[model samples]
Target: MEQPVHHFSELFEQLGLASDAEAIEAFIQRHAPLPESVALHEASFWSPSQAELLRNALEDDADWAEVVDHLDASLRKP
Candidate 1:
């Protein structure tokens, strides 16, 4: 089964915010830099190592908006 989709609000909450899209965006950008070499649609490219690195970064930094915008754009890419 596929993982359920979450609204930006939910993501914000998960990231420890009360409720704020802008804030969530800020948090993600500060912490999660999109992997430059990974193809967004390549499922296999999102390996465990990549995930761990993302997780580690998120754990450390929690403030940045560009990351959220990048993620949104990447997801919309064809």
Candidate 2:
């Protein structure tokens, strides 16, 4: 079975970011579309811990993997 869809709030919380609506909107406006050349883990916007979380999620294909992958694709330019 497919996993339930994960919300951006969950992602923000996992990254230790503010998950309030205002914060989420501001974060999206500021960083939603990261450059094509910038890997998710390399984005300066993330804290070191957040970056490490992303890296580990991607590498390990853990429960967070699907959301992390969605984030990776969403952030990058097509």
Candidate 3:
């Protein structure tokens, strides 16, 4: 079964980020609400492997998809 995402911090951990409360909040402050024109995979903040993980999760609709998608949207500029 797929795990429900409980917090942005969890998403950060899955994405290989720091995942601590301060780190997660800092990351969000820095990167959340990405511009509409910027594709998630093309974000400058991600390493190639990290981008690949997100791309694969989204393409496969795997267990990570929900959280990945949440991150994708969160990173977009409103």
Which candidate leads in TM-score? 3
Q: How accurate is candidate 3 locally (lDDT)?
A: 0.77
Best by lDDT: 2
Candidates 2 and 3 compared: the better one by lDDT is 2
1-78 in candidate 3: lDDT tens per residue?
A: 746545667767767889998886678679877888878878898999888888888899767787777777766744
lDDT per residue (tens digit) for residues 1-78 in model 2: 776677767988999889888887677677878887788999998889999999998898777888888777767633
Off by over 4 Å in 1: 1-5, 34-78
> What does candidate 1's lDDT look like per residue over 1-78, in tens digits?
643554657544544454576775564455444455654323343456544443554455444233544454644444
By summed lDDT, which 10 consecutive residues of candidate 1 come out lowest? 38-47
Q: Residue 50: error of model 3 in Å?
A: 0.3
How big is the positional error of residue 33 in model 3, measured in Å on the Cα after superposition?
A: 2.9
* RMSD (Cα, Å) of model 3: 2.3
Clashes of 2: 0
What's the candidate order when arranged by decreasing TM-score? 3, 2, 1
Residue pairs with clashing backbones, model 2: none
Q: Determine the backbone clash count of candidate 3.
A: 5
Name the TM-score of candidate 2.
Answer: 0.77
Local accuracy by lDDT, each model: 0.48, 0.82, 0.77
